[model samples]
Target: MNGDWFIRGRDGRLSVYLPTDDAVLCRAERALGGSWEPPRRLGGEQRLRPGPAVGQGADRYTHLAAWRPTKPGEAGLVHSTHFRPHLAALDWTPIGHPGKTGDRTGPPAVAVDARGRAHVFVRNQAGGVSMRMQKEKGGWDPWRDLKGGDVQGELAAVTGQSGLVELYAATPAGILHWRQEKPAAVPTLEEAMDASVRPDTLYALPTSATDTTLFHTDDSGDLCAWRPGTKPTTVLPSAGPSRVSAVRCELDGHDCTLLAQRSASGRVAFAAYPTEQESAGAWWTESGPQLPADALVSLTVDEEDRVMAATLSPSTGRLLISRRKDEPGLALEAWREV
Candidate 1:
């Protein structure tokens, strides 16, 4: 899980969802510098893993997907839920499982395409990928298998300019495989990339309507990015062993990408690509407060271009959410326990 569970409503308010002991916690930031409301439980008993995927559809409703164990020490399924942000309080609709019963991999990857349909991807126990889509009239379609090689890690998905969804997953041997799906079509695994170095975590960011950039950390602890026509470029050397999250966003009216990682040293660090000219050099790195030794970091950008990061502290068994300050520079403020 490496992305935010937050989505911005059409009215500009940001809502973030986190999973607590046996419930999903919901909190919202009021528009126009208003503070965040007190946390409210969304009402579910299954324990949720960090890295839940969330997207705002054209209908102005927020959709979310998360994985929870069916039983202690058993395989899990990916579940879908949604809410209308305009309502003061939310009752999450149980949208049912988007994956099969044996699906037991990482958190679901979700994205709302141009037509406002919600698409979700998860790994099945068979080491293949499964996909499900929201119908025009509202319910999800049956899970469709997107066959691939033995995928050992989570899948990264992003909607492309043409309304096609692209998926990326790394094989156990460190090779990356990608595929694209159009509306009402099955996806086929295309050619694979030769990434000899395996990454502990991987993230993908769509840089434009037609292009996307893949970011991952090599075994040498370097943060690297792979573009369409270029070789893998080391964005930051010595990033340390950690999961990396990235989002394509704007900074001062310019297109940029934000990268966040919790290094082996227990420090949460962030770097940004402000512009094309600054993409090759050392990013503006800002180190945040120390995290728990076993903290898992997930990063996301809200509708207001504010970067939100959630770290699950295993020591306290608490999930902490923090927002980057609105200043011009890439400075992150302190974390607030949710």
Candidate 2:
């Protein structure tokens, strides 16, 4: 499974959730680029296939949601819990199943709105979407169907500046559909490509209060982005068939978007999309450290805009976490495995 489950806490620490043989493992760095705590198991005794979804609410608690097999040979069920950042130990609560029995498709995806409520989204077995929200008084609401037919991949959720939540899902026909939580809002479809794309890896970047940039890799292996009312822009020409992660950050005092993915040669590489004033070109391609080949990588930015990357080695299936050292320029030497 791809390493997409991660969240940067309000205190600037980075935590990642990974699936193991019998449990879900969580590893956290006390601070960006700092020493990491030992892995803590979070419920699940059966095999957890895809990774979990994690989000931090305004209340300073990090929420995690995931699905694990019900039995050795059965389908999976969804579960959730929240933990305090300063605590060394965890107390996981059971947030029951979001989908019907034998209906879970991918792991859950979560987004905490400004009201401090956690919203969880999951793809059902029938290729449709379902969601559940945490109540202000504490328990979860009943599952609500979002009802997108033939939804092709994992759902992505983000709360916009107006405190409105939006969701994105891909279709088998390479169309990206989005819906807003506000009344009178309906799902809007964007034709991202003419051919089918990898629907499982859709990512939405809320660049501003009113503007969001959606990113996804097409079937042809190109990294593409779409802003409201604009055509899709190709960010990386050939990101095909690899896991891609991106975050908006400041690079040398300039607002930029950083993208990390496994290169065509199988090694992990990073590129930068700096503001016009910071660069004459569109992308500073191949800027970060050289990492091991065939490793699945996940990228995130801390409160200070420093990039943290977690990589899973293909040979041993072990995870190695790294961060960019505080430096003046973007260079391979600036990244150190921690």
Off by over 4 Å in 1: 30-32, 43-60, 67-78, 85-107, 197-200, 228-230, 274-279, 296-328, 331-338
Q: Which segments of model 2 are wrong by more than 4 Å? A: 1-6, 30-33, 44-49, 58-60, 71-76, 85-99, 183-196, 275-284, 287-294, 314-317, 325-327, 332-337
**Model 2 worst lDDT run, 10 consecutive residues:** 275-284
- Top candidate on lDDT is 1
RMSD (CA, angstroms), candidate 1: 3.9
lDDT of 2 by residue, 223-307 (tens): 7776656666676565436657777777788787777776766556677776222123344245344446656677776676677
Q: Give candidates' CA RMSD values in order.
A: 3.9, 3.9
Could you tell me every candidate's TM-score relative to the true structure? 0.79, 0.81
Which pairs clash (backbone N, Cα, C closer than 3 Å) in model 2? 221-240
Kindly list the per-residue Cα lDDT of model 1 for residues 1-338, writing each as its tens digit.
33445556666666666655445666667553356677665534455655566655555566567666565554454444455543543333344443444434655677666667777877765677778877868777777887776776656676655666677777756545455555746556765676645634667666776677777766776777775455677777645576677766676676777777777677777777753333557543546667777676767666666877777664465666777788876666777764
